[model samples]
Target: MAGIDNIMAAIPGGSTRRFYGTAHWDGARWWAKLGDGPNNLLDAWWQDPVQPLQGGKIAVDITKDEYGQAASFVIGGYTDQPRPSSGTVQEIIPAGVATQIVIMGEDAVAYTTDRFIGEYSPGDPVYLTWDAAKPTVIGKIGASAPPPTPDAPVLVPTNPPGSETLIATASDTYWAPGGWGSYSTSRNGGEDIYTGTWYGNTVTGAWFYGAQRPALQGKTISRIRFRLPARIRGAGNYNDIAIVHFYAHTSGARPGGDVARVTGPHDIPVPPGFAGGDVDLPLSFAPALVAGGGISIAGNPYTGFNSRLKDANSGRLIIDWSS
Candidate 1:
């Protein structure tokens, strides 16, 4: 599933809106006032807070409809954070620790940083995720943050056990030649990269040039994602498609070995108007596929061409380096 901000951005009509507030308990009812300063501190709503009020000051997000009706709420989250991007760790709690670090310009602890904030020299840049009154840091600027659990369900297995996920787009994507040869010699080269196999209705086994992305140059891939718009080849026929092969090539120019594969009629009864979602295929390379940094990928369908991944660069690959 897409994040809240991502979802909101996708919505064309702005019927619903969100507001930030500072929560409080007015004797009995849990209430929150706008964070826009004392002069404009309007009580947005009086709803149950999301988390235990560890500290007296708790940040909250109120979700309301156009008519000022708050439907839900979020606590100590990104919606109320003072800093939206990277900030310097001005002061650590125990002089060197990052449990609670203050931003360079702030008078209070900006975030309850990650345990693996990585040896910061008191004033290192770090990303953060607000989790109530305690915002969590993303780690040192150089290291990637581990989103162990996916924000929401995309395809199969709501939350892949893997800690890190990197989305990479396919580069040099095109239809493989009648004869599998060099990538440059394809019919549609140097264009938007696309992937997936096509076991044609005709006896021609013309697969995609292969799903290769430059962003995923030399990393070890542990999972791959593809959009499955279950629109079959011909309306009358029941294509018992089995395996969707996921290929990644770290050595050669084209996709070589299988990075992952899933076999099933997962979307059997293709709905009325071709409605289907994403699916995450898991990868398994024995003996720990420890390459330099990242891994590139490519793949084709088992039967008919049935992948709906085409957004200039929307292909996604997950690496087990835990990001």
Candidate 2:
């Protein structure tokens, strides 16, 4: 097993179930063995809506068979999906002192966690966040990076507000080459254009670029805007504009339910050369997000515009909402 299952789960039959190990292609479909166990409480079953990528870790769900031993386990989600959380504040930076944190190899800002608690003195769990990356901090936290159950992690708000902003920099990007397990990368490294099948000869398809919006229970989004930095489009994809789609994100940040996408300065028009200045992509969609429900975004890889949008945390997926 590449990684052991941290969460425990229960099956109807009786035996405890597991859902981690090296995910592999079994000729027919992809699967990872539930680590040897007597576990029952379904550990970390974040309703992932997609398949595992090669070399990526896997989460499993028992299907059809009785609850005890389960007839079969199906790949439920890619572990390491949520933006890695840096447990506890290593040190507290005042309101706007500008800070940085390294998560899963990406440099995340310390201010991203929603309304840091007044009593948060360092050692406490600072991993709570509305989304993964970006500058500003908002309100409420969704799921833990890993280990925590599907129930969204909650923090006592310092002075709770009716509004919160989920920045794009606070997002997580995962990649998979072959058909094994998926791994996460900091949004620090700009995400790629949605190419669906980024693999060439051996590997086939699987690249999810997205951010997990915080569980803003009882509130609704007031405005949703994507700030895209200057970018250059190529002839490969007919220089078409990138279109982003939103979906219900499983707890682990997996591309669940429907396919998704990502990238920086994603939808601005560019000439053959580097487009100057940042531009906001205008989207016309209902801000009908369920109060406090976890949501996600995915890139439309069919466009084949695999160019890199290499801006720092400046380019973001800004979501503003009120209760």
Candidate 3:
């Protein structure tokens, strides 16, 4: 028997519009009264009452037997809000009572809504556009890993007889000499002659340069050639003697573990009339050049013999190889 004013005062936000009161059982069923103020409408609801109350709008909880169903109605509440235009799938609930999904968009804002458009896993790109006045999911773009590339055979050009491709070349200078020890210069014979003396020790008389040939990496070295104006100097019969030794290193300083070696003095003596000529020695030892490594060449005179290698402007060490 609670009056309208008493019911409005008993509930939250008393005397406000749509002010509802606590529910109770009037012996037969559950009943809740609401106040609509003076000159406004009165409201009442019941779960299992047979008679209607006087002077009020009556509403009943019709879904009393349905499990997990909401029994009350709200005027300005929404079950799901509008999502953004574009986002990425953050999570998905496929087999739950409420099948829904979560997405993340700009400013890292997250939104959870029922999956209405398509099936999506996590990290799937989604685009939503307004269609017929409703936000509808239009497309899903997924990023998959690319396929691996297969190894192909390297194409090598066929050169004519006695022709070769120059992989790398290094020259010598009298001023720097470039790691060549026991170096001496003689200008007494009207021409400047450079000499790198070898004393059987591997540390002395060698020249090295950077051997990072990107084009020659992983390629088979078919042949190697050396071109240097050299001679057996001093008062000894050192004809047809091995004077220079070529090597390869993985890193740092000359003569560091010979990865490949090529000997000089191929039984052909120095040219007549000329002081020294190009000692052309073609080597047939084919070694596969390892990646990230370098090449080096050092003078290794036969035991006790002392030799001289001269570079007057146009001297070079050449490497000929196949791809």
Off by over 4 Å in 1: 1-83, 96-99, 104-109, 114-116, 129-134, 139-222, 229-262, 265-278, 282-323
The sequence of per-residue lDDT tens digits that candidate 2 reaches over residues 1-35 is 22232232233332334445544555676545444
Candidate 2 — worst ten consecutive residues by lDDT sum? 200-209
lDDT of 3 at 295: 34
For candidate 2, the lDDT comes to 0.36
Local error of candidate 3 at 25, Å?
Answer: 99
The estimated TM-scores of all candidates read 0.28, 0.28, 0.28
lDDT of 1: 0.38
lDDT of 3 at 130: 41
TM-score of 1: 0.28
lDDT of 3 at 170: 30
Model 1 per-residue lDDT tens digits across residues 16-36: 344444565556665545433
List the pairs of residues colliding in candidate 3: none
Cα displacement (angstroms), candidate 2, residue 70, comes to 57
